[model samples]
Target: MGWNDMQPLLVQATQETLWMVGLAALATVLLGLPLGLLLALTRRGGLLANAPVNKLVGTVVNVGRSLPFVILIVAIIPFTRWVTGTTLGWQAATVPLAVGAIPFFARLVETAVADVDGGLIEAVQAMGGGAWTVVRKALLPEALPALISALTTTVIALIGYSAMAGTVGGGGLGTLAINYGYMRFETTFMWVIAAELVVLVTLVQLVGEGLARSLDHKRPAAASRWTFRRSVPTQTSAAPEAAETAAQETELTGSALR
Candidate 1:
């Protein structure tokens, strides 16, 4: 097909890729966050620590992460069929994309949550806050930026996975690249799809990084405000005592001189 003829196809394919990646990323986050939190909390000495449960979940996540995307797509064909009622198209493609991404996202969440200050958890507990409260207030809030970053990574990975899904009749930019660009010897079409994918992934990363930076920027300001509030009372309390002591010393000196 000529470039003009291929324009509509390219636009449609871009939309398909975006739709698949966006939905899959959303699903991954919804399912992965709690699962990852469970992993973090169930680990030894965690708020809801249960060693056995942690190990079991860790193992499952690991196994899922270990599979190659293409292999995962093939391996989960039956589940994909069951979920989408057909093992083809962008919708069916999302099943594997989401499935593959959940474990990966969970692991990222685990890492992000694990990095949260243990002291924060302890302080929350000391306040009589329960596990859920700590998780909601401390863990999730503290890990928000990192989780955004993880979602960004998962979305990029899903884009690649969706393209790979094209090989298995999963349609998207990948199908466009393969069917029109690669197989049909249309180099220009292939490059166009490739460029679009690059642009898409780039936009995703930029947005993710921007959000993370914005969140991170707020944290230091908040910490500084808290520190300032905490220190003001100490400084104020000391001023009166210091002034009184100095006055007392002056009085003693004047009396001695007389």
Candidate 2:
């Protein structure tokens, strides 16, 4: 078929691919982000350390990551069908795509969050901040750039997974390529589809890079270490004690010199 004939097909297929990848990415974030945070926080010495929970969560994430997308989609066919009421089309494809990617994204999130400087957490805690407060103010803000990069990686992976979804009647460019290019021996279709995918991935990568770079403003090395107010408490309840301690220290130093 000529470009005139294929134009509509290409547009529709592209739309479907975007829909699948976008929705899956959203779901991956909704579920994956918290799972990742939990994994990071529940580890030994973390803000909310729990050895048992950490091991269980880690194992589950590992198992989920072990399954390849192709097999994962097939393996979870029943669950997908149950979720979306059909195992065909881009909508249905999102179920498995999100499920497959959640663990992957979560792991990346854990890595990113884990890399945040421990001093920031300590600083927050010294200010009388709880785990939730530290997570919100310290960990997330500091790790945001790396998290964006991780999300970029996950979205790119979803694009590939979307292509694989096409083989199973999950409609997208993958379906078009397989149905027309490979199955029907239309070499032109194969080339065109491949080109489209390349362009799409390139655009995603470029945007992701821009965002990551823009947010990577965290200070380098020792500068990133926030000076924790360990001796003087900042809260209203602790102010009196901090003043008393300061006065006592000053008096001791003068007495020693005299």
Candidate 3:
């Protein structure tokens, strides 16, 4: 296809890709966050610890996470149809995409929450805080940066999975690449779509990194440490000068007395 002919198709495909990825990411977060918290909190020594419950949830997550994305898409076609009343568009594609993503994202969340300091949780408990309070005030807040990073990684992964969905007639840039680029032998179109995907992923990574860095208070604390170091030398230099001046004054007073 000529550049002029491909523009509209590319635009529509790009929009479809975004729709699939955006909705799926939202679903992943909604379902995964709480599930992940459960996994983290129900562990052996966790606040709500229950060995059986933890093991069950972990096994479920592992099973979901173990399935290959393509196979998962195919395996869930009936469920997709039941959910969206169709199996060949952006909406239907979301079912598998979201399902594939939820466990992955939940695991990431588990890791993020696990990384929270035991001391902080203990402090909260000592202050008469409940489990929910510890999670809300200490765990979530302390792990916000890591959680954002994990979300970023998951979003990027979703973008790739969305492209894979195109192979199954799930409508997106991947579909465009497959139908127009590969099947039709339109190399130029394929290259353009590939470039667009690359650009989209790059932008997502940059934004994720920026947001994570912005939320990280350690950067400011480190900067303050540097400022303290810079100021210390001046104080030390002034103290020596002050001591010398005091000694000189004392000698002058003694000479005058003599």
Candidate 4:
């Protein structure tokens, strides 16, 4: 086929890929964030520390993560159809993408949240902060950097999953690549799709890295500023010390006057 003929096909494939990936990322974040928090908080010695719930959530995450993507795509077809009302197309593809991504994202989240300082949580508790407040003030903020990195990893992973979805007629760039490059022996078409996928992956990685860096509170400048500020006494503290010294001096002067 001529370049002119291939342009529209390529465009459609690209859009489909974007749709699959974008929707999957959204779903993964929404579902995975809570699941990850639950995993972190319910584990042994965690704030909420429920053995049974932790075990159950951990088991489910492990089992889901263990399954290969293609198998997962097939395994969840029934549920996908039930939830999405169809067994094929972009929407149907989301079901498996989400199902596959949730556990992966959750594990990442668990790691991120777990990396938060236990001391911070203790401080919050000492201040009478509840679980939600602790999570909001301590865990999430502390873990924001890792969580952003995890999101980047998750998006890249979803791109790979989108390719796999093509096998089931989900019709993305992967499907185009397979159909033209493999079946029809169109090397140019195949290369085009492959290059596109590479570029897409690269872009995702770059954006993810940038976001992770931006969200990271551990950067040298921020850390240095925190250290400097902490080393200095606050005005509130210095003011009281100054007032007490002045009061003592005044008392001495009064005694001398008498």
Quote each prediction's TM-score. 0.83, 0.84, 0.85, 0.84
Global lDDT scores for all candidate models? 0.79, 0.82, 0.83, 0.80
Candidate with the greatest lDDT versus the true structure: 3
Residue lDDT tens for model 2, 168-195: 8999999999999999998898899999
Q: Tell me the tens digit of each residue's lDDT in model 1 across 1-258.
A: 687899889888888888888889889989998899999989898888898899999999878877777788889899999998998899899998888888888987898899999999999989999988999989999889778877776777777778888987788899988998889999988988899888887677566655554565444543332433443334453355335534643453233222
CA-RMSD of model 4 = 18.6
Name every residue pair that clashes in candidate 2: none
The residue-level lDDT of candidate 3 at 118 comes to 91
- Clash number for each model: 0, 0, 0, 0
Candidate 4 lDDT by residue in tens digits, 1-258? 778978999999999889988999999999999999999999889999999999999999988888877888899889998998997877788889889888888987998898898999999999999999999999998898678877877887788788878878777887888788889999998898888998998677555554555555575643442432432333343344335534643453233222
lDDT of 3 by residue, 1-258 (tens): 788999999999999999999999999999999999999999878889989999999999988887888889899999999999999988899899999989888988998899888999999999999999999999999999788877877887888888888998999999999998999999999999999999998678656655655566765442332433443344452354335534643443233222
Candidate 1: stretches off by over 4 Å: 218-258
Q: Candidate 1 at 2: error in angstroms?
A: 3.1
Candidate 4's displacement at residue 253, Å, is 77
